[model samples]
Target: MLNRMSDHRLAQLNIAALKAPLDDPALADFVALLDPINALAEASPGFVWRYVDENGADATAARPFGDDLIVNFSLWADRDSLWNFTYRSGHLDLLRRRREWFTRMAAAHQVMWWVPAGRIPTIEEAGERLALLRANGPSPEAFTFTDSYPPPSAPPTTAETGTPETATRAGAGLTPPRPASPSSS
Candidate 1:
């Protein structure tokens, strides 16, 4: 199903714990590949914005989970746009190589949510979403790619599993006001 909402953009946060510092020889390859991968994301269709450090470099230095963990926070036109870039583009190989440079996170390391277009989510807001995912699993508030959620703007009927029904005034219990025959003199 096309889970992406038209009225909202998708915001995503991916965190990875580093096995070694970026300058370490063991992590050189991973470090070297970051620029290219980031460039690919920027060039991809539907990419909206990405969070960068004050210097405007990659987000690797913006570690919310202390010095060891890194964040990649960005916004896309929708889920499909991010899915295509992360899985279908040339970045796939680099992504698979993550095991070499990053440690396995105990809980979920990625969280995604829908936000109003042109809105930039603060790191604290994203951290809360990540915590929510770790504590509660996949909810509409915060979710993962494998288990995504539609935006709040989705049509009410389609958001849940139910046969579509057209309710009449009688069904809804709102009676029309009785028409006055004529105003009493």
Candidate 2:
């Protein structure tokens, strides 16, 4: 699923999203709220691709498996552009008023990770990755602001075949699960 675009191309790609849905009537209205910003982000510098869910018409799905959750995924050239758009640009205004739009979530709401140059991470993959971070901590696959992990310096190397494989999404190289919180001693 890694698309393998150049760093230069990645620099030109713009990607960002809102965490909440403004409307629930048939769900189309939520997309309507996103329409203008999506266009604006696409126009912005460093914009690449966004994970869209056109009511299941799009290839990559962000549809939440549960009723209260929503996920948006996308890629960008670097952190600066994403930071600017998310906190300093027009998008920041929308984010400021998120309570008016989105349902409050108890889990990690937004996250960022580096795909192999051009790889688009699947939603299920991303969701699992997020869960890993929430349950354990950040490694190559998952991280957060309190503990940010820079993208890997080199793609993973395989020892057995002496060749690389697409990074496994099924828990390979994943952080070990956290032990249960001990009862008070």
Candidate 3:
């Protein structure tokens, strides 16, 4: 997946363990929001590309991890771009409600790495990157937003070292996911 990184883009993969089947009534609300949220990401600033299903829609049917899990894989122009879309957009709203639709995983469920520009990373490649991150923590090979590595050829800068998402997170007043009550569903 790394290919020739003379030019690169940020690749990220995040998996969620479903609390129930996609068609189950318990997941209806989550399903309903998929389209709109996906559209938002596509329209976000610095968005490069996203892995979609056969219909050019969201990646709901992608289960590279397991039958009970689904993935969201995409490329961003840079670390800051990904960080802004992830933490400063409407996407964060869904993240807060993750407990309602997904099970808490025992191990790392997200990873970010640099890939060659214009390269479309395969699901198998994503799996390997995630595995690498889980086993070795942050490295140039694989990492996360909180502990990211710069492009193999670029020097680190304040924007990468001291991400602006910190201020955005605090200003947004982000709170932890609360217990999902049956009545709220």
Question: How high a TM-score does candidate 2 get?
Answer: 0.61
TM-score for every candidate vs. truth?
0.79, 0.61, 0.77
Model 1 C-alpha lDDT per residue in residues 66-94, reported as the tens digit of each score: 89888999999989999999999988998
Clashing pairs in 2: 2-119, 13-46, 13-47, 13-48, 14-46, 14-47, 14-48
Runs with alpha carbons beyond 4 Å of true place in candidate 2: 1-32, 53-62, 155-185
The candidate scoring highest on lDDT is 1
Off by more than 4 A, model 1: 1-5, 154-185
Of 1 and 2, the candidate ahead on lDDT is: 1
If ranked by TM-score, best first, what sequence of candidates would result?
1, 3, 2
Which ranges of candidate 3 are over 4 A from the true structure?
1-6, 53-57, 154-185
Please report the TM-score between candidate 1 and the true structure. 0.79
The C-alpha lDDT values of all candidates are 0.83, 0.55, 0.81
> What is the lDDT for 139 in model 2?
62
| Candidate achieving the largest TM-score | 1
